[model samples]
Target: MMKLWGRDTSVNVQKVLWVLDELGLPYERIDVGGPFGGLDTPEYARLNPNRKIPVLEDGNFSIWESGAIVRYLAEAYGAGKLWPADVKSRALATQWCNWCQGSVYVDFIVNTFQPLIRVTAAERDSGSLAAAAERVGKAFQILDPALAGHDFIVGDELSFADIEIGALMHRYFTLPIDRPALPDVEAWYGRLKTRPAYQKHIMQDWTTMKIPGA
Candidate 1:
């Protein structure tokens, strides 16, 4: 059996967990991070020097980085499904996977999400938050056209790209900043909620985040 070390609430960790659920791959999870901090420990650092949550160990291979792990799992265990076998198609789908890290999640995390993490501690920055939201909204505008009529982000079929974006979308919906209305965004997100694996692993209660007004 494979072993995964990370916290359930971590967005990055959620990515891998959703992929595992999608593939129906059984694995053991060891809590590490947040309330249970072992990331900087010698053992944890050896596997992932970055000290990030979600490090996967399968047989003799140990992998770090949430997105990379999801891609690997899809390729190794779900070639035709989460990861398409076709070259061009796979390239297109993978683009959004890479986009999610720098585009969708990047701006949002820098803005609203940062302040929300230490809510009761008082570090809200209305100006910066609004600016970041504007940037994030612009990215959504790009997605709006891309998702015009598609159920998933990549193509007609579900892929790791969908799962990656879906996890980030979950955070946006739960963020303190009121969600901007984007019909296409809403519709795409609605489709994800219908997926058994997505709901089971991604639709977590926001209250647990203890993100103040959450």
Candidate 2:
């Protein structure tokens, strides 16, 4: 059986788990990182030099980095669907996947989410949060138009691009902050809720991550 090392609470780890569940692949998930606190060990370091939460072990082969792992799984198991066998379609989907990590995640998740959930009220910086929110709004404005006629990121069918971007939707909608009304984005989010894999993994309760008054 395949082995996955990471905690359920981690967003990066959750991405891998969601893919696994979507593919109907059986794997043993070993709790690590955060409160589990096993990421710094020598054995874990050998698996991931960056000391990241998620590490995928398939027999003797090991892979780290959430995005790479997701890509690997999709290529290895999910063809003509989640992986997108067509070259042009795959490229388009990959573009959105990269966009989510490179652009959306940095401003929305790293800056806004980290402060609101991880940092206490006393330690929070209002200026930084406001700046992050502005960036997030701008990012969503770009996304809203891209998702105008498409139910999913790439097309009508679910793809890895949807998996990557959809993972952050729960936080985007639920977080206590002023948000511009992007009807297309909101409609896309509603469509995502219809998926079983997304419902099980991405739509999980995140109240524990939120600090008081956050």
Candidate 3:
């Protein structure tokens, strides 16, 4: 059995949970971090040196980093569903995943969210937050255009790429931030909203997010 450790409301954790749901994979989730707060313990650190939540433990294997863990599952178990096999196809899938982690994650979750929602207003870095919002808005423009004719991020089927990017989309729409036009992103999200597993997990008030405007 796969065991996940993180709070339900956490955006990082939500991504992992959302992926598991998409793959129809069963796993046990342990509440940690945020309100739960077990990430700093020696036992927790034994799994991840960074002491981050959303660690995935399967039998003797343990992996950290939300994106990596989701990818591992998709590659190992999901295959054609979330993990593409062909070189070009897999590259395309991974392209969106990398963009979510590198570009979107940095702009929305890291810069703006870290300051605005993850920390209190008094403790926030206003300049960085505003800059992050600008970058994210620009990045969304890139996605909005690509998603114009497509229902999902990559391939005809719903892949981990869609699952990965959709998690960030939920966070972006919820935040009190100015956003660019994203009709396609909106449509894509509408489809995701219909999933039973997404409704079961990912949607809720954040309990321990440190961002300010949240």
lDDT winner: 2
Every candidate's lDDT? 0.82, 0.87, 0.79
Off by over 4 Å in 1: 211-214
Please say which candidate is ahead in lDDT: 2 or 3. Answer: 2
Q: Over the stretch 7-52, how does candidate 3's per-residue lDDT look in tens digits?
A: 8777778888878877777899999887789888899999998988
lDDT (tens digit, per residue) of candidate 2 on 138-202: 78888898888878887788888888888888888988877888899899999988878888878
Task: Name the regions of candidate 3 deviating beyond 4 angstroms.
Answer: 121-127, 207-214
Best-matching candidate per TM-score: 2
By TM-score, highest first, what's the ranking?
2, 1, 3
Output the TM-score of candidate 2.
0.95
Q: Which residue pairs overlap in candidate 3's backbone?
A: 116-212, 117-210, 117-211, 117-212, 118-210, 118-211, 119-210, 119-211
Error of 3 at 20 (Å): 1.8
**In candidate 2, residue 59 scores what lDDT?**
88
Models, CA RMSD each = 1.8, 1.4, 2.4
- The stretch of ten residues in a row with the least summed lDDT in candidate 3 is 205-214
